[model samples]
Target: MLTTLTDYRLWALPRNYVKIADAMIQEILDSGAVFEDIADAPVEYVESRGDLDVIFHELRGTKGCNVQACYDPYIDPPAIFVHLSGNTGRDNFSVLHELAHHQQRVGDAWADVTEDITDRAFIKELREKVANSFASRLLLHEDLIDSAFGSGPVTAAGVRWLFDNSAASMQACLYRSLELEGNRVVMQADSDGRLFFSAANSDELFPPHKDKTQEEIARSFDRLQASADGSLVVRGGYGIQHLSGKSYTNVVLDMVLCDGCVLVIATKGRSEQFAFSDDGEYYQGSVCHDSFLIKDSPGRCSTCNEPKCSKCKSCGCPDKQPPPCTRCFMLLSVNDVRAGLTAHEYC
Candidate 1:
């Protein structure tokens, strides 16, 4: 079954990248600060605060330098700095990333205690990932993304709307959308077509980088980039062969360009297979045939007309013919896509 952000609970972030980010969000909520419309004004809380300092200046370095932001948490008054070389969207994300670091440092004294750790490289990378996750969440909160998708289909244009409104980079918006409510995979490659990072709800559904050489991965990347025309479905052995060991026969790839990286969101053609229900009950199949057998099950399985089934209720089944299930591809309405794209047109 596909897992949504809600499945992880309000502040329980399961991914390693967002573990500290979740804690930071919980701290904000616990402080009684109202963040009702954070997406529109992300810096509103910290901008007027006396303790946090934000700076922007010309940050130059050697050629091909990609350092656009930095955060200093050890100082008396925490500070965040962003390179003045990027666009508004990039600068927004940089500030939020540093703020994420500030939140972590304030919440725990031991957050910086890893200085003595031998793995400095690993620690640095982990901290960056956490900060990135923080920036994404701070701008595009779980509730906000959930509500956006509640009435529409998730598309590249929909993600663009999120980027336009929130203080997140286009890449961050795309990545977070992939993690929301679908069995999706987001593969990121450099301009040269070298695969650097891949995030997916299921490892089995995504192509495994561990088994492929850099050249092989590059070839697959090229194919995906060439075929991607906003949205495209790759079928049969042509596309499946590159995936090698994956069990899926086909994949729907949504490609978008952000900065210098190509972000591709891949959805498997086959439904997910699992043996458990949301209510902590063990099951053997995708749908419950006789939901009444389970204790404390909901009245009936809306998907299958079975009594006492909690899975159907958990998925919010509409009780339509061939009932709505997370295992299959969701039918997206064209109107929903258009509405989402033009959601902020008048604003």
Candidate 2:
């Protein structure tokens, strides 16, 4: 099966760009340069590949440019100007993103995609997405992600772990986590509840233009318990009523606060069956009777050995049907007949 990362790249980037990016990554790996440790010296590694000039500039308020970095292939030997954000992870991403542009310029692949695209805005956006795909792949290699998170469910703690442990930026980890679990939305918002970034793999769209902030999402971070690595985490369902009058009711939010931003990993709300602790070490199951959360009993399926919720008795398998009622001669659901009963209780 194709990994979520592969699927995302195919969707976000042009085919030629993907091939070029993969080839570049493979070249780096073939050089015996530890690919997983690329974050440690990204600038050095990028510079080693070719003759490129690096410049640090304050790019704020620059007309026609709003990004933190840009590649200028017009200069002698080409130059990549980066505006440092002081955050190592984010800064490294900016550098790699610009380097990807440099590669595109050198390979002359720009001609391949630009001919048919008459819309300047679309061309610019496509180029940026292509560059982002390359940078994200370089920083968060598939192998590294697989090693960090094996085929387990993506959790808020897992997202926090990837950001805290790897060289990838928080946004990169959020995007990767979304790819891993395509049904959820991974969003980043300020402490004041203003949303700046969000990505979703689900059909339910986020509010158009991504500028609106709901106070409820921001307020949800209050009094959240902090884990060992200083990420504040909390889990609950909330009504995602955007300020623009668009609303989605009963969305499950798995939130974490780190580096002054609330990262909300959300899915469509469902009955609370099980919940993981802030560190993901403890699992709490809920009973159907009261939907009360219970602790310390991690039940398993007898046949498949798959873990089940001890209270609700839910596992990887589908709901089991009770034997048919002898009188009615119909397969019985749990509600109509009790287990091991050949006849309905009423019968």
Best by lDDT: 2
* Per-model TM-score on C-alpha atoms: 0.53, 0.63
- Could you give me the TM-score of model 2 versus the true structure? 0.63
Candidate 2, overall lDDT?
0.58
Candidate 2 off by > 4 Å: 1-24, 27-37, 59-66, 108-120, 207-210, 226-237, 270-347
Q: Write down the worst ten-residue block by lDDT for model 1.
A: 282-291
Residues 142-220 of candidate 2 have per-residue lDDT tens digits of: 7767766779767666777788777878987786675563467677888776787777653332422377675666666
> RMSD of candidate 1 to the true fold?
15.2
Q: Where in model 1 is the C-alpha error above 4 Å?
A: 1-19, 36-38, 60-67, 109-125, 151-157, 187-198, 205-230, 236-249, 255-263, 271-347
Question: Would you list the clashing residue pairs of candidate 1?
Answer: none
Best by TM-score: 2
- In candidate 2 the C-alpha lDDT for residue 50 amounts to 66
Candidate 1 structure quality by residue, lDDT tens digits, 1-347? 11233321211222534655666666766776566544445556667566888776576331221337676666767767668655666676667777766776676522533334454544555566666776777778866676556556665445645665666766678667755655565665564545655555532244436333233224444564575443333322222222343232334555555444555556654323322244433221123221222345555454543333344433223332232122222222233233553122322
